[model samples]
Each structure stands twice: as C-alpha cells, then as structure tokens.
Target: MTYCVGMMLDRGLVLMSDTRTNSGVDNISTFRKMYHWELPGERIITIMTAGNLATTQAVISQLEERNKAPSERHNSLLEAPTMFKVASIVGNLLQDIIEERATDNGQKAAAGTFSASMIVAGQIKGMEPRLFLIYPEGNFIEASFDTPFFQIGETKYGRPILIRGYERDMSFESAIKLMTVSFDSTLKANLSVGLPLDLLVIERDHFTPRHERRIEASDPYFAAVSTSWSEALRNALDGLPDYRMDPAVKEILG
Candidate 1:
C-alpha cells in the first residue's frame, strides 16, 4: 500500500507520495511512485501512482518511452496540446496495462487483483493548472471549485484532515503543512505507508517545478510537523466539550 496526494491551489499544485510497498510484514520495500515530464515553457505533467506496482511501473515506462521517441508521433505526453489530452493518454495506458496483466494471468479485470490508480496534475502553457484522479477503469475526474484535491491509496486514514483543512487559495507553505499532517495521520494508522516521501510544488505558469525534495525519516521539517500534529490533535480532542452520561443509564449501571 501507499499514499499519494495532489492538491490544486491558486498558487499552483502540490504533490506528495510515500515510497513504501510491502508483500507481507516480513517483506517490505521502498519504491518511488511519483513521476513528472516537463517541456519547459510549454507544459509540465506529474503523475503519482498507487496499487499494483508492476502495473503502474509498466504504464510509466511506456509513457517515458513515448516521450523519448520522435515528437511527430503525437503519442507523447510532451506533444499533447492540452492537459486533458495528456490525462486521456495516461488513463488509456493504465487501463490497457491492467487489462493485459489480468488476461495474461487468466483473471477477470473486475477481479481488481491487478489494478492501479493515478493522480495526474500539472499545467499547459496558457491554461490554468489542472488536477485529475484517474481510476483503474480508464476513467477520470478533474478537480474543480467543489473538488480541489485528489488522494489515492490508503486514503481513508488521512482524508479527514484534507476535508477540514484544504482551501483553493492557500499558499504553498500552508499546502505543504496540510499534506504533512495528512500523510502523518496515515503513517500512524498503517504500517504499509512509511517515510521517505517525495514532494513537488509547481508554481502557476512556471511549467516546471518550483520546489522538489524527498522527505526522509530524518527530515527536520517533517519531524517537526509530525510531532506538532500529534500534539494538536490531542489538545483539540481534550478541548472539545466532554460527553455526559445519561442520568438513567448511569443509575442503572451503578
């Protein structure tokens, strides 16, 4: 399992994903799940994946290969005229890979044993930045005014934080802080999601990443954020109005 989040903000876009993958408690490993392709000044595309590692890897590898081929192919993400088209290409590729794998294994695609999902976020020159959540079925939904964020993989544990804290116009600093809290919440709840997270911040119109870094277990800022969030949660719970026992129920128990 893993966790990846892509948040759309007025500033640009913020993306983060954990590197942990495990087959069992005894067999754990780390693998990068975030990838991006940029055509400086023209466009920038970033994808964060979760689910069957092989399926996601294959899809990414094929996209990379297309990127390296001639620009005339028009099959490359770089040559796609808009972010929508880029997303279509990625979604189709992801769906095809999952179906192929399932067929090779003599299993039904609906079995979902070989499924994967992705969050594709970035901007094309002359357009407002966009964010999408692509599912295993080759279908996707874009982030908009009502939905300005996407989270994939081990999502439930961290979803509440995002729901309560995300804002469409928040600064990048605030977005990063919010993401850390979300990721930290998941890390505490699930052993499958661990440290060494990859983070990328793309500023509007830059067509390139404004900030990119990997937050290892030892990263100071993440450490501080994790500790602070825990304390905040405890304090918030304690500060909330206490639950009072019903008098009749209490008397019966007594």
Candidate 2:
C-alpha cells in the first residue's frame, strides 16, 4: 500500500507520491512510484501508481519501451495527440497486463493479487492541464471544477485535511504545502505509507516541469511542516468552545 495525490489548479498541476512498498511487515523497500515523460515544448505527461508492485513496474517498463521505440503494438505517450487519448492508452495497457497475469496464474490468481491504479496528469501544446484517476479496470474519470484533485491508495487517513483546505486557485507553492501536510497526516497514521516523497509541478502552457523534487526523511522543510501542523492542531482543539450545562436549566432542575 502507498499514497499518491495529484492536484489540478488554475496555475498548473501538482503531483506527489510516497516511495514505500511492502510485501510484509519486515519486507519493506523503497521504490519510486512517480514517472514522467516530456517533449520540451510539445508535451509533458506524469503518472503516479499504486497497488501490486510487479504489475505497476511491468506497466511502466512497457510504456518506457514503447516511448523509446514507437511501435504499432501500442500508442506511445509521446505520440498521443491529446491527454485524453494518452490516458485511454495507459488504462488499456494496465487492464491487459492484469488480465494476462490472471490467465498465467490460472485458478490460483485471487482478486487484487495483480491489480493497480494510477493518477495521470499532464498537458499537450495547446490543451489545458488535465488530471485523471485511472482504475484497475481500464476506465478513468477526469478531474473537474467540482473535484479538483485525485488520491490513490490508503486514502482515508489523509483525505479530511484536503477536503477542508484545498482551493483551485491556490499557488503552486501553497499547493505543495497543502500536499505535504496531507502526506504528513497519512505518514503518521499508516506504516504502509512512508517517505521519501516525490513531487512534480507542471505550469500552464510550459510543456515542461516547473518543479520536481524528492523529500527524504531528513528533509528540513517537511520536518518543520510536520511539527507545525501538530502544534496547530493542538492549538485549534484548545481554542474550540467547550460544551457546558446551561446555568438557568441546572438551577431550575435543582
């Protein structure tokens, strides 16, 4: 299990994912879950994946290979004319992989053993920024004005803060700050979701990443944000009005 979030904003798109994967409590490892392909001024595509490691890696490797050598077997992410088509191709590929794995595993292939999903975000030269949450079944939904973000994997523990604070017009910097806090909440609540975090930003019409980075356990900014959020929560709790019995009602009852 892992956590990945992508936000669509008026300025651009912001994406984040944790780098932890585990087969068991003792068999944990770090693997990058975010991927991107860019053609400088032409297009930029990013994918953050969650689920079975083998399935996601296989999907990514196949995409990378196709991108390197354009083939009739599949449409390369680079060759897709629109972001919508790019997502369709990716979703189809993921579905094919899982189905193949099930066939190979025969009756032994239980549910979710070879399942995965992705958050796809990017832009083409003339198109606006777009975001999609692709499911394991090769279907997807685009982010809209009413829903400006998508989250994949161990989601419940971190969703509340995003719901309360997200704004579609927020700056990229502020968006990243919000994302970090979201990850912080997940990290504290779930052992399956751990650092380091990969972050990427694509500004409107740039056709290239505006910001990309990885935040490790020792990252000072993340450390400070985590500390500050804890303090803020405590302060908020303290400031809330407490419930008390009405004095007149208590006296009348007595």
Candidate 3:
C-alpha cells in the first residue's frame, strides 16, 4: 500500500516515502508516511512508516504525548541516549499497538493491516548517523556496508534498482537520485503506491536535516527523473543480447 526507503551512506542518510493509502480500488486517500522530530544542534530523528494508517498514527501520537508529559517515565525520542535506543523505543511502541489492536478485535491482523514496520534514521549529538528497519515484532536491524539500505511495504518492485546501483559511500546527490529511481519503478508497477513523496537528507554529524522536500505529482525534478529513468531502462534492455537459433534447430525443437 506504500513504499518507504532509507539509505545509509558515508556522507549521511537519505529517506523517502510515498503518501497513498487505499481501502479498495474505488476508495483511495493521501497521507504522509514520514515524521520528523528535531532538537536543533542536539538531535534529529525521522521515521517513515508503512502499514495500517490507524496503527502507525496512534503509535506516533503516543510517542509525542509521552515526550510532552511532565514526568516522563520513559525515554522519548528526544531523551534517547543513542540512535539504537530510539529505534528500540519505537519498535516496542509499534509492537504494543499491534498486540492491543489484535487482542481487542480477536482476529489475526493481516500484514500491513493492524501490523506496521518503520525505518528509523537520525543522529544524537554524540553518535554517528544510524539507520534501522524496525519490524512488527519490536526487533530491528541496522544498515551496514553489506546492506546499506532498508525498504518496507510494496518493496519488491523497487528493490532491483537499489541492489544494482547502491554504494555505501555514494554522495548525497547520487543517493537521492537512486531513491527517486527506485520509487519511480514502484509507481510504474503498482497503483497502490502514488505521488507526493516525502524526502529527507541528513549530513553526518550535523544533528539536523540538510534537506527536506515534498515531491508532488507536478514537481519538475521528479517528472524529469521518472522520464529519464524509463528511457534509460528501455535503452538498456534494447541493448541486451537477444536469443537466436538456427532454423533447422528451431524446427527440430518444435
């Protein structure tokens, strides 16, 4: 129903997510899947979610509420000592919400229904930029040089490009371009994933976002990227060696 990606690069991190939710072919809506919290020079955290809209929204709401409470019994995003801790907190919250919803309804919630997964990326003042893929079970895995990116929800259509082109030390510009291309591939193959993408870039050790953008359907850069990528793919496919067989061999096989 949605697609979100977070890439960990040597220079920084890049995150992007689509903004579409649908109950059926006739019922469709747009809702942002990206959320960010910033403490200026101290910390910056961004979360991109994919799954049941209600469940994700509730988790985010509860986190925000806890952060604002006078006697915070737990570490909110702002209070987390490290990026790993922040991810653990988010994963736990997501798991709790899913369990509560499933218990109240007495049904096994389908994947991406009462269940959700998130990509958490950011930095605290003393730590390096980190990226995590938080699963529905309250456990997560961080990106490493071997696996420098994480994607969730409707991901299969977009994963090939990342697999072929991703580099751990790529520049910020190249990373965003690769991400845009990945999103473009998904958009072409799936109707459930739609436009108005949210993109955020954080340079290493900045403790703040370097770039944040919303790419609407009419955005020129997005349009150009999509068109160019399509053309390039077509050209590449055309250049691949074609299969040929001798007429006698073909007839014998037939």
Overall lDDT per candidate, in order of appearance: 0.91, 0.92, 0.90
From the highest TM-score down, the ranking of the candidates is: 2, 1, 3
lDDT of 1 by residue, 1-254 (tens): 99999999988999999999988878899999999988899888999999999899999888877556565344378888888998999999999999888888887644488899999999999999999999999999999979888899999999998999998889999999999999999999999999999999999999889999999999999999988877898999999966658987666666
lDDT of 3 by residue, 51-153 (tens): 8889999888888885566565443898888899999999999999998888788756554359999999998887788999999999999988889899999
| Worst ten in a row by lDDT for model 2 | 66-75
Candidate rank order under lDDT: 2, 1, 3
Using alpha carbons, what is the TM-score of model 2?
A: 0.93
All-Cα superposition RMSD per candidate: 3.6, 3.0, 3.5
Task: Find the candidate with the highest TM-score and give its number.
Answer: 2
lDDT of 2 at 30: 99
Which digits, one per residue and each the tens of the lDDT, describe model 2 over residues 1-254? 89999999999999999999999979999999999999999999999999999999999989877546554444289999899999998999999998889778883654579999999999999899899999999999999979999999999888999998899899999999999999999999899999999999999999899999999999999999999998999999999965559987667666
Window of ten residues with lowest summed lDDT in model 1: 66-75
